[model samples]
Target: MKIGELANRSGLTPSRIRFYERIGLLKAVDRKANGYRSYPAEAVTILGLIALAQGAGFSLDEIRALLPADLEHWEHDALAGALTRKVADIETLQARLARSKAHLLHVIDEIEARPDDIDCATNARRVLTRLLGEDAEMPVASLRAKQF
Candidate 1:
């Protein structure tokens, strides 16, 4: 089929299809005598898989590495290993994000706990003390020197 039909069938833009072809991800394409791109019916399926993989956090390079030259044959063990590694990577990221979210929530709570009579600097010191221990009481110049 033509590029337009392939784009419609694959739910991808013409430019994206062209980009995939250019990047060596979509290999089952041919050039017609009239200079139009001709794609096999399987191109639709290939494009779908590429999109799915991307949604699952696979980079284009990773997808290219995972894609078999011939759709009929796959290196099952390699595929399984790569998928397992990706899952682990995602889990690590989730844990880090959860910690970051919790830290932000804690900071928000501290900032909101300011007393009516205390000045802004006092409240800032109180929050910093709660977060950074006695080090929050150190002089600004001392902190700057310590940073280096």
Candidate 2:
């Protein structure tokens, strides 16, 4: 089919499909006598897989490396290894995100624990001390300068 029909069937924009072709990801394309792009039926399936792989955190380069030259043939060991590595990367990211979330919660708790007796400046200092330990002793002017 033509680019428009392929885009409609694949749920991808024509520009995006052209971009994939430019980047050497979508290879099953031909130019007809009328100088329009023609795509095989398999292009739709390939585009779908590309979208799914991107959603699953596969970079375009990674997807290109993983895609088989022939659809019917895949290097099973390579595919399995790449997937295992991606899982490990995701687990590491999850651990880091959990740590960041815990730190943010701790900061929120400190900010919310302000005593009525203390002024805003004092409460801010107190929260900063709890959050930053020894580093919180730096003068506010110096902290402001460092931020810039």
Largest TM-score belongs to which candidate? 2
Q: Each model's TM-score, in the order given?
A: 0.86, 0.88
On lDDT, the leading prediction is 1
Clashes of each: 0, 0
- Expressed as tens digits, the lDDT of each residue in 1-148 for candidate 1 is 9999998999999999999999999999999888999999999999999999999999999999999997999999999999999999999989978987997799899989999999989999898888768777788777666521
Candidate 1 residues lying further than 4 Å off, grouped into runs, are 119-122, 134-148
**Candidate 1 backbone collisions, by pair:** none
Which residue pairs of candidate 2 clash? none
Off by over 4 Å in 2: 137-148
lDDT of each: 0.91, 0.88
Our model 2 lands, by Cα RMSD against the true structure, at 3.8
Model 1: lowest-lDDT 10 consecutive positions = 139-148
lDDT of 2 by residue, 29-122 (tens): 9999989999999999899989998998999999999988758888999999999999998999899789879877987888888898988899
Q: Residue 12 in model 2: shift from native, Å? A: 0.6
Candidate 1, residue 142: Cα displacement in angstroms equals 14
